[model samples]
Target: MTPEDRFPGPEHPDSGPRHQPDLDVLPYGTYYEPEPAGYAEAAYGSETYSGYGGARYLEQHWPATGQAHNVHDQQAAHPGYEPTLPDRPSPVHQGDDPPTIELGPPLAEPVPAYPYPAPGPDEPVGPLYVVGDVHGYLEELRAELRHQGLIDADGHWAAGRSRIWFLGDFTDRGPDGIGVIDLVMQLAAEAAAAGGYCRALMGNHELLFLGAARYGDEPVQSTAGTASFLAAWRLNGGQQHDLDRLEAHHISWLSRLPAIALEDGHLLLHSDTTAYLEYGESIPDVNDAVHDLLADEGVDEWWDCFRRFTKRFAFRGDAGPQAVHELLDAYGGSRVVHGHSPIPYLTGTVHADDGAPPHIPGPYIYADDLAVAMDGGVTMEGRLLVARLPI
Candidate 1:
């Protein structure tokens, strides 16, 4: 079967062959080496799962825009394949009836309105704010940032000295992932020009995205059934438009993001897993280890790294507080702030039987008040959170 037959375009049934762009002219396309012999047969031989059948959120046929979406020449090699934006379902309306939730006993101590003592006149750093997972909800992100007075109406940094740290998962599962990254990159520059700074952590999706871009359809060993980086990405809400629009700069910026950070006594990370321990014991050591691993071209190592980051829910059971302490003891933080497992899932509130979206008011402080869950599950009709620390 042809590459086109395996990964068809929006108009697969009626589309005719189109012009292929010159690979040498596209910098991003260099990452797309041709698939190995019989790769299409080995990877996606069955007609049932050849295309978008196994994936969620991705439409069978997305309407095409006139612009060229296949910046990756590897996609261009497939004569009929053309990238398009995902047409995800709309979020549930706010007024809809919410599902029944079993309430647990209230926490022994409520989250303090003011956890930290007010800074005196001589304080050096500005107020610190951390953003939750932004899985391609660019507009929602903009609105929330504006609401927080971080950015102005024009989307420029308006907060003069207040720092912002984005807990990652910047791409995938929604529309305009590239646009979101572009905004963040732009904001980082803008924020630096001012007194403050904007930064991000490396999420699991970041690993998946990098793996898919660098390795493409190459086979990877998996505990699950047959898998490759590309297939796994698709199954886990990878957007065609994001991949198609990925540029060299975006790749560089994402690859260099730190896997973990410490800010204002908060241990900031992307996922809720302790897999980070495997990389390094110290903060710099961990980030350095992650960056070094990605710098190499070994596909199996990349896949393994991606898998390790994907583990979650470590801070969610009777041993949850102990789990939080494990990270704190190594990382030197009073509390852990994260954004991978959403609040709904952590609270057992994922299913909204009454047709309403899962309600996530703000950051969830749990794991014996040692960990903070910032992911509001934007991909699942929940909020995209941006919060101040010590909440």
Candidate 2:
């Protein structure tokens, strides 16, 4: 299908004002409130998809040394570069006044619930939860996780034996990307000790950050003239503070994140694009291919991977359900859960620069109820979404 054919116009029913519902009492995904109309025409209109035509997808990939010694060698080769992490695990900055993010209000009315059955005595896993794109809004993230009973007032993992998967894009666009990463790393360790595990996926922004850190200003070929990883990252909301605080451990952690995961009958991915099919047919093969690429030193190949994953809206419009089916057929998930295209983008009500806040009810269920969008568009003054799965 043509690029324009993939998105719905304002006249389309999916682009109309959503039926806002009360969130606290409802089990998510029991019903669906379609995102606003005109989102396609408003968001992707006039954008070319051939080679990074839009600002959202305007990022190139990276080339890595593949070994610790090589990274150390690169640091030595480039003087005055010290990669050291902060000793503390808090997302709040030390000494400075805490960054204040005025989060948007949640849904208005009540919806039906779909509670999962309690695990049997032999059941090994606990409750499952998924987090959308954080985009460096550290405080908002903490508040949302706390609201979901995942983390406690102290910000430590309190959901014992419960699994939480962050759908990537942890850094950029807002304040304290590094702080967010540090917090996630800390949670992963703490959760494992508590029997519950906290893990993350690799988003396009991760690739952009890694490219900037590894390649710096090294030029890469782009359809929009010559581009570099650092330049693209900055253009796509890369924060100077994040870059300054980036350490070797952060790099290693980000580098090793998987592109996709299958959890509790949900296929979790960072982006909504069907480009994952290009990597491999099954989950392990796809992840292995991406990991292998990141472990190599091919700049263009890495850029291609990043660019492909950056593609969004593949599972939207009329063909959206079918697109989701393709992934499910190969990956063994009843639903595809992702975070890249923000919920507002699907709603078409709020832009990133809009002064007013956008009302995001909860995880958007679409694609004929076969896919769920977790991003609450935190970067656009929208809510940071943390949801329990099967919703």
TM-score of each: 0.71, 0.70
* Window of ten residues with lowest summed lDDT in model 2: 1-10
Per-residue CA lDDT of model 1 for 66-133, tens digit only, reads 32334332332222333433222233233644332212112223222212233355646657888988
Question: Which regions in candidate 1 have their CA more than 4 angstroms from the true location?
Answer: 1-123
TM-score between candidate 2 and the true structure: 0.70
Top TM-score prediction, candidate number: 1
After superposing candidate 2 on the true structure, give the runs of residues whose Cα lies further than 4 Å from its correct spot. Answer: 1-123, 351-355
